[model samples]
Target: MSKTILYARVSTTDQTIDHQKDQAEAAGFVIDEVVADHGVSGISTELKEREEGKRLYDKLRHGDTLVVRWVDRLGRNYQDVTDTIRHFMRQGVVIKTVINGLTFDGSTKDPMQEAVRDALIAFMAASAQAQAEATKEAQRAGIEAARRDGSKYRGKKPSYDREALGVVVDMLGQDKGASEISKATGLTRQTVLRIRSDPAAADVTLSRWES
Candidate 1:
């Protein structure tokens, strides 16, 4: 029998995979298994490279189904997301998203059906990619504005382990963008921007926190 598997990822401590499962269950999907990756941002990492994502490849089989909250949950870029879906489709696996109830199957042979399916996949994948970029840009802008206003950072308090913070500083030295650093480190963009805006202050904050 084909299994319906759910894959969920939480980029930050503030998020939960349970929410993704809840959303899927509410949508009436009978999930046979759930694979979750914690403290990993889908926007920065490819699905196949993620820890739990690797498990997915081994578990999914022909005629099985993969369900997610959205295409962005699968990948952050157009090429990455579509390529993933196409691979599963070639395996005779169906991909479904709870948010849109999207169904992607490779069972169609008609010219028009094939064309429409490919077009929709391209459109959705592009939309997912664009949404990720827009969100990252907005986050960076908001952080920059907060820094300029000399106001406290907005949203949940930024927290990270010492090692992760060190990675942030190292990436900053390499002149990476705040959003990129945030995504790469799984740290909040606001925290990345704050550190980027004032390394001295960040040093003092780190010293105080360490003490």
Candidate 2:
């Protein structure tokens, strides 16, 4: 019998793998192995590079099936995610996801079915990639909007320590660039520049350095 392999990854220690596993199990997959990589960002890291994730690639075979929570779980970008799934399909590996109960297999001989399946996969993968980018853009826009009118900002209360603000001011006083101040004080360049640009508000809250 072909065994179902579960691949789960969390970008940080704070993220739990149980949620993903539960989703897979609820989808009726009897997981034979659970491969997980912790604290690895899906945005830039390739699935093949992950320690546990790499084993899934090597161990999965023609009769085996791979399950993930979503397509985004498989890869970070549109091309990368689509390429990885297509490669597996060509190898006779069945891909399934909990989100949509979608399945992709290369065993079908029907050209029409193949074309339809491939097109759907591409569309869904592209949609997933676009959603990820949209989320990032939304986050950036929110930050920018917050910066324009600090009163409307609803972020956490500023808690920048006195020492860090002192370093930032000293860096500015010395004519050190934002990048240099970021490196020296462990504050982001954006934070350094924000402080330099608005000393009054920066001194009051130091909001830029809080996060």
For candidate 2, write residues 63-153 as lDDT tens digits.
Answer: 8999988888886677878888988988889999898899988899999999999998898778877887888899899899887986767
Pull out the clashing pairs in model 1.
none
Candidate 1 vs. true structure, TM-score: 0.72
> What stretches of model 2 exceed 4 Å from their correct place?
12-15, 150-211
Report the number of the highest-lDDT candidate: 1
In order, what lDDT does every prediction score? 0.85, 0.82
**TM-score, one value per model:** 0.72, 0.69
> What shift in Å separates residue 188 of candidate 2 from its native position after superposition?
20
Per-residue lDDT tens digits for candidate 1, residues 30-146, read 999999888777677888999999999888999999998988888888888888999999989999999979899987889998899899999999998888899999989988887
